[model samples]
Target: MNLETFTLFNFWSSPLLATTAEAESSSLILAGVLLSLAVIYLASKAGGELCARINLPPVLGELVFGVMVGVSVLHLLMFAEAGEDGSHSLIMNLLQATSPMGSTTFSHVFEAQSEVLSVLAEIGVVVLLFEIGLESDLKELLKVGIQSTVVAVIGVITPFVLGTTGLMLLFGTPAIPAIFAGAALTATSIGITAKVLAEMQRLNTREGQIIVGAAVIDDVLGIIVLAVVAGLARDGQVVVSDVVYLVISAAAFFIGAIWIGRLLNPLFVQLVNHMRTRGQVLLSALFFALILSYISATIHLEAILGAFAAGLVLAETEKREELQRQVAPVADVLMPVFFVIVGARTDISVLNPFVPENREGLIMASFLIVVAIVGKVLTGLGVFGQPGINRLAIGVGMVPRGEVGLVFAAIGAATGALSDALNAAIIVMVILTTFLAPPLLRWAFSLSEESATTDPASLSGNISEPVLVESERLQSELVKPEIQ
Candidate 1:
């Protein structure tokens, strides 16, 4: 070695300090992270398979598995997510049992490891919204026309107003948390509904078309609501002007980005066309999403919105199908992490009714569950001039909140906007609604099928056969693992 290098090395590695403590700490953190990931993957896959076998959305499996390994159960994974203390991580407990880590150093490692996993979960969600954006075909709504728009608007307004007002008046929930939960109620898990319709051979029916179109619109609207609520939730309190500004800003940002992105599509396509490297389209799309995520974060909106807008923009290009194909593997790798983390962070023990203190939360959860169902069920009444339309089926189709609801729950929890009882309440609503919708939708259709055939005029809405033929190609694809 050179004289200077030898002297410096000797100084740091004398008999007093032959070992690199920083390197050792880094190794411990890495080891802990790797072990946690292995557990998550195993649990997620097992849970996913079980859920899929039962004809349920596999994403449900991920959340259930997460709960099994999380704060309320096995404790294999833990985080500071939504007020959870990183120091309570059972992964850290295992690491300490296996290794000779000092208590102070162990605390540092656990906190650092938790931070890393939390960031990974954030990235996981961003990728999710990106993929969801790719799947959303706004043109499909063209065939369903104003009726679907009516359903979407009514679906959003009804639940939001009822849930928010009820929480404020009945439960005395703070405005921000109440609003966040209410906005969450506005989401429709179209994926679950889509699968049910396809299985029943009713995917192209008038009610199915309206449900699919409305669900897509609400998902779009739900993403916007998430952005605004997240922004308000972060500030710790909501103000009138701030709320108005966030609403306007989020709407403008999405519409403006899509508009500008369309104008620049040819240029984007040209850039991709000129590239000869591996993953040209996938990499470009991600680059665009990440850049937009950064811009959204800078402007006080959630980064997921930017990622979503990126997906929306790129989806308009000629490479949509290929881009979608390429995006799945990446999502498969990351999306489960986000779901698992949300489930792990959720402490459902608060929902137990036996405990005196827990009774209030349980009561609140019951209230939320009621509102979640009735609010969406009311949406069916919004459709005008379609007497043959199965309004009950349309309402039932919008019932499941699925992953989109969890997105709100996760964000609210992470921001500390939701109390433990409220978080548990939201989770209960999500799980039950997701489970209830598919079967309920089938029942709605079954009850209406005979009438549909008897009333020749009833089977037809403003929908044309040709438009529905094209829309079928879009509706038949159910919500995938991430968003359903």
Candidate 2:
């Protein structure tokens, strides 16, 4: 029963007791991949449920579970070296090894599988962004455009400066890692913030509108920064002309995508709606998103950006609700995969305070967390000139970095621009900000409510009410033609 002496036919005839090395190795790897998916989905769902029970975002639980099962804890998905005599390692055997695949072969297989999972995870984020765009009202967004832009600008600038300066001064880290730290800190996860706001029944509030609007603007700005930093990292130096080119290209892509998408949306919708097929509209919507995503990637911007723009185009159509309904199921399946992948990528070892080797990383993480918090808090002040607004609530609402921050950190790590220690620190900061924002925001809104309730005179200069009315009017006008 020597594996080296057996033919492929004999190995295929009895897969479990395969005698051919190639057949056995391939079968084992396939089984491992299937098992890994099962484990990841189950762990992610369980963790999400646990977090929900504790009144926290389910993503937190999913991420923590991923860390638990990943290399940092259970070592279930990590690839380790083979044993002596070129045999399969203990993990491979435990997962049901059929033959010895040397460490190199196993490593290659594992890496390939990981890349596949990563692609799936990225698609999940794209779907999530598309959904966000679908739910958004572009008209309302424009009403708060000025305020949102200011808040977004300040939010990006303050965090970037603080993150870069703090890392250089406190940790004496190299410039690339410091820049990445700053970039990571600039991400504000609108999904998490919007969910919390909706749960608290404040999504229609002025502060809520401002927070959501600002987050959307922040996303666009953050992507541009990421593109610039990635370019600088690749070239190993920031050429002034190169920086200008990157900035212009990014700007042109975003503006052009939105403008062209808007111009063509009506015609596209009309064409899709005229179709007699049952699900033609939904299919067309998905195709549109995928095509835009492809275009974004082709132009060197993130695909998610194109997906978001596609959603925006579809959002303006009369079939927006129908499109959203059809896409929801797909998003649900893939989005969790993205979050879990992010969690699995996080290395818990560097965050262990008890480990002497991790003490510096732990200290650096602590400092970054502080900076992340304070920097976003200052963004609340950008709401100046608007009365009766709880700036604190707005700022707190903007604090959670969530999936967007994770994406930035993942990019940095993948590019080798961020070291393990720095990546760990960024993740810690992301986790803390995400974990703390919900309760803090709830408390801030409560204070605002109490103040408004206790004093009738406190509403003298409230502008949100009038703006809300105007927003309602604008929405009515936009929907009037469809209603007819």
Candidate 3:
């Protein structure tokens, strides 16, 4: 339906109309929705099981299952019977429902699927971030210290070089675009790595500490780089003063937020502790997150960074353990929906070969994907000190580019620094990174199977122990503490 004529209830159109022909179409559409959800649910569970069977992370399975249920493979399977002849068969009927949005055969079914996917995916992201926030411990991350700095530096440098250089070579002389592309690849999604380590029982070890430290550093540095690149893309030249201020300002926000939280931590906890209902605590904490997020956005930084920082500050409070625990289940349900939506938003047909006109966009997308992967892989070398440090794990961890990358790409597209093809390419790259990491991590962790089940060798050299400690902290923070 056209945007102008659409109403929210239009989404609730009856799948089964009164006329026989229309009723069949409606029935098929309803059946299709149920089928899709059932498949996704089963696939996700199967994927998780497959991961355990193969000694890989369950998330890898989840992603693969998503893709299978996605338009890419599943839809293709559903449509396969439409070959050669304009035949009449059940397979052909199935194909109609699975076709892209414009297919006359099953437009309603496709639209409903798309809408469901979007809502779920958005919910997934929010919950994922919230859960990550819930798991974080301010005191522990602070204690991570110099190692985190070094890891962050190495992580930022490697990807910046690889991403920019690769892009510049492929698309000659628009240095600023190249820089933005590279900057987009540099941020690390610690949640993925931490989850993998937790699964492998390595989170408490020294290696886990380094990973956590490096991830925090990478995140902070990544934003600063994005800010600078964003500024350059908006204006033809790099603004030195603006860049300096952005960096300094971001640093100050983090430092200041944590400092204030430390001071207010006790009082906030005491207030929440006295509340009769637990919702009061959750509402108050969420309020803190929102205010921080708003202030950060005002300073031209991503609100998520503020939210994350706020969570860290709260991590030091006496109620830190209780607060995290209470918030976790809410996050768990919401987060998966977000991921599903991410997959649904992706219009795979946009990268079509049949549409000769859009081929340029496809080629551009292919190039960006290459740069995105290589750039992050190069960042793997950032894991220093321990010879045993899983460089592959670090590299894979840096792979997925989520909100941070999208913001940069969107800005680039909006400012005309990037053409339509290039913008699409960046988005494709982000999706690829998000999709690829879980499997890669599972494989990397599996490679060290012998070591995973063993005891820690030493503090700095031990990857397993640190991962365990981190997970435990996450559990304590997210799962409510036992009441007296």
Q: Which candidate number has the best TM-score?
A: 2
- Model 3 scores a TM of 0.67
Q: Which one wins on lDDT?
A: 1
Give per-residue CA lDDT, model 3, range 1-484, as digits (tens): 7775576445444432336555565666566555655555666677778878986777666656665655555542131211212122233356464643234545554444445544454445434544455566555666655656766786678767876787678667378777777777677766556556656666545556567667756776876787677778877667788778878887888789878877888889888878897488778887888788778779876565667677777766767677777777665555444444344334456666788756776776676677667666665565556666667665666667654566677777777777666676777777777777777766665666656556365534676778889999988886675642
TM-score of every prediction relative to native = 0.73, 0.77, 0.67
**Which residue segments of model 1 deviate by more than 4 Å?**
1-19, 82-88, 141-153, 164-238, 384-484
Prediction 1 TM-score vs. true: 0.73
CA lDDT of 183 in candidate 2? 88
The alpha-carbon deviation from the true structure for residue 160 of candidate 1, after best TM-score superposition, in angstroms, is 4.2
**Candidate 2 per-residue C-alpha lDDT over 79-109 given as tens digits, one digit per residue, 9 for 90 to 100:** 3211122122234456435544667667655
Which residue pairs collide in model 1, if any? 191-479
The alpha-carbon lDDT assigned to residue 286 of candidate 1 equals 94
lDDT values of the candidates? 0.79, 0.77, 0.63
Instruction: Encode model 1's per-residue lDDT on 370-447: one tens digit a residue.
Output: 999999999999988876678999999999887678778888889998997788788878877876776687678778
Angstrom error of the Cα, residue 24, model 2: value is 7.1
After TM-score superposition, what is the CA distance of residue 477 in candidate 1 from its true location, in Å?
Answer: 45
